[model samples]
Target: MASEELINARHAATAGLIACASAFVYLLARGYQARRTFYRLRQQGMPMPPWNFVLGHLLAVPPIMKTLPEDTQQPDAFEALCRANEKRDADSIIYLDMWPFADPMMVICSPVLAVQACQEHDLPKPPILHAFFNPLAGGANLFTMNGPEWKRSRALFNSGFSASHILEQTSHIVDEAEVYAKILRQHARKGEIFSLDDVTCWYMMDVIGAVTLDSRLHSQQQFNPLASALRRQIRWHVLDNEWNLLIRWNPARPFVQWYNSYQMNSYIAQELDKRYAEWTEDEAATSSRSIIHLALAGYMAQQKDKPRPRMLDAAFRDWATVQIRLFLFAGHDSTSSTICYCFYLLQSHPEAMAKLRAENDVVFGTDITETAKMMREQPHLLNRLPYTTAVIKESLRLFPPASAMRGGQPGIYLQDDKGNRYPTEGTNMWILHSAVQRNPKYWPSAMEFIPERWLAEPGDPLYPVKGGWRPFEHGPRNCLGQTLAMHDVKITLVLTAREFDIKHAYDEWDRLHPTSKVKSVNGERAYQMQSGGAHPADGYPCRISLRKH
Candidate 1:
């Protein structure tokens, strides 16, 4: 009986070994296939960095990262990689192979190529993006949806983001911006440096929260659960650009991710249910007429001749949970970065800063303290500040939070102006907005901060070329929240630009830390880094001083 038991144990151990070996072989085969396909595309004229079959282009990431600080976040590596390779306008498209982790991804540096993929082709978002965003939404939303589902979602949400609607919501936006300005005032009073990014993140939370559902989440003033969860979700998120495999695959990550999702989704779902309850009751229930309520109305319109249900459909409610989550996350991350960079740029360029203030003061009055109140009273007046608008545009062009990332599909290819076709199958597609926007080939003096580029006449050399400046991107699938984002940024700038003189505190931060690496990206101290979405490095530590008028 003992001998029989020993034989059975030996057989089971052998089976486990065999299974492990087979799985290893399968991964090896997949890796080889990726290399073979990537090399074939390279041979066909797609520019790629020197390769390491096992590590793929990840081999190149470290060398570029070494040039900057160690703790710097992702995407800075890819942008640095482009510069290191001396990638030129002619070299419009570059492909990188990242196998056994992520699929191969391509970066389009030329506007012509960007349009081909984003505008003309309108390619679907690759699966990897869905995987990246899964922890946050865990289901289809506007940003990730493609084809029919995307079309339907886009139509439904379009009304909420219409130009007229955004204008109407301007006063609500100012309410939040006023809170943000008050926070800045507190910082000014302390006479100590503070992280503008930190406060901006909170302020944007309240703005979008208020605008979306009339949510009174005063994240700026106090600890807000929804806001905290949103930040955690981004911090916990492992983007493809996060090159650390171990961190990406950490076991602890799932629990935190699941919790954050639950916390945020439940919070948003309650809001939805409350609104739906109001929606169904024709007893003239008080409604916020929020972006979400408008969206819910749109959903009801799609019911056609079906009987008006007493309760929101469970399935639609479930889907709307993820979409609202998308709005909160996307709105907060993208605009926060823009606002920080605008301040950083204006701080650096005193001339442009003066021009911005002049525009604001002339439009809203030199009594800077009263501008926020006046803006709320006559929100339409905010539209009259062209130079202020120019500053925001230039900031976005210089440091776009992110571009539209599309998934490659079978039978689809991107074409350059020369009519050369580049197959996009089996790879993730990116327009690499930073590259296209900052390239001197596309915009003269591109590396410099110039707001006038947006206002240049037809004959000026600094004039923005058609299809070149794509901060919010261009085409059918362009950002749905663009009008609102612009209004949000503009409102914040209007309220704060004249009242406070904000400047980067990187020098002091470096002094205190004493061991930080190279402080600038091509001589600009406030470089874009990955936080939520392309946030400024180290949350843009800066000191705000009340400008003495």
Candidate 2:
């Protein structure tokens, strides 16, 4: 009787526990369903692509999530997709499936919508999606900051990257360009197949190093660890692979990333401490050459009246580190890619090359050494290179280095050209730069390389379209270092073109891709480049020769 009674009590306790467990799970599922329903209701009026369970639209899947499609490999694939969607519903917001359980994102392709998002309504950046940018640019940096904080941080940087300040540093880029030309000449002598994209990146790194650190990083000659680390961090952040998975799951990848970050942060901190001490110790001895010096001066001037902020040392270090990283990464990569594309485009279109070279000769004169001397002594000559400027402009129009992203706030909306309003709440907005810049309505024969379009008279049909050409973007948050980028590109083009005549290594191109030629941007049966930038997938393999007199 006692054993039977004990068994009965044990069975009752078991039943009680199971009942509680089932009730808890039921409530949890009910809550999840309610949230999902709320999200679906929010997206009721929006035009979205078909979404899969747990994948949403799968558009924002990390690079590791699936095999890259051939169609999606094109640099302008996103723009192409956006164009297709616009045809279906011109006034509707184009939705992109991010991760499941997250808000769906919408892309803004129209200039009117882009301008409205940026100017009239201040849209914040999407949260968590831009985590990749956090390590390089901290939360406090201009890229990550919002509202009043961004304005304050941006103001300090303006002193260093202003038009006048950038022009003053023109000789610095000219000197860097000379060094780059020497390296290219060596490669030309060997008749080697080198990656033009890689070489251009190295040259731009050296240029940025000189401007920001006031030191020749010598990255072109020797590999710099910081530069390597920065590149690796970005590579890992974007391209997820076995190594990146280990980075998330295992300790080894994390260690490598941490070490690189530490090494870079330590170097920048030491440099900041040394420079600040020098400035405080001696004013006359402090040569204000680098952006670091200029920004520090601005900080000091601003802080003189206001009370010292807390943790000023750490804050300034972070500020300087972000700026250095920005210049090193964005400043270098964008301009270098632009330079590589300029060469690639010019090689394909010999007529454009001839026109550019003629302009260089007319403005810079035929003597290469004399031109170098003038570049060093007369920086103002850069302003007179109008056709060269136009060439760079047209190249940028074809290939914008980066696109703009804006997060929608409550009550903020986008309007179509036909005056249709699209509510933006709970949606992320991306300004598709490639689509906007290449609109056929604004630019006739948009895919063709035509530098003359920029030189057209005001009343002419080929005249510069108002608000149509935004290579560096537009509005308050446009690229801060645009002037600097343009200056570097112009200097590199002039000096390099003056010394070397570049030609595409068509044999090597065939060897790299033995198959049929794919249609490039302008429906031309040319080497189809599959990349996010203007460079080819295989990189621009080219032969170079000293220009015949």
Among the numbered candidates, top TM-score falls to 1
The pairs that clash in candidate 2 are: 57-97
Tens digits of per-residue lDDT for model 1, 257-372:
88988888788778888887776775255444566786677677778679888777888888888888888888888998899999989988999999988888788888876887
List residue ranges in candidate 2 displaced over 4 A: 1-45, 50-55, 59-75, 88-93, 101-103, 239-252, 287-289, 302-312, 506-536
lDDT of each: 0.81, 0.69
Per-residue lDDT of model 2, residues 1-549, tens digit only? 999999999999999999999998986675455446435734665555554544455543433223232323332544555555554446424666543334445666566677788766767767643464665543345665678877876776677787777888877787778889999899878876777877887798889888887767777888787667765665444321122444446556566667767767776676777777777778775566576776677667768887654333676677778777766667787788788778878877888888888988888898778877887788888899888898999988877666677787778767777666776776667776666777775678877788898888988887866656766777787788899999999988888876787776657777776865342444432233423223444555677877777
Clashes of 2: 1
TM-score of each: 0.93, 0.83
TM-score: model 1 vs. ground truth: 0.93
RMSD of each: 2.4, 6.2
The candidate maximizing lDDT is: 1
Q: Identify the runs in model 1 with alpha carbons over 4 angstroms from their true place.
A: 1-15, 52-55, 84-89, 283-289, 302-310
**Superposition-based RMSD of candidate 1 using all C-alpha atoms, in angstroms:** 2.4
Question: Model 2 scores what on Cα lDDT?
Answer: 0.69
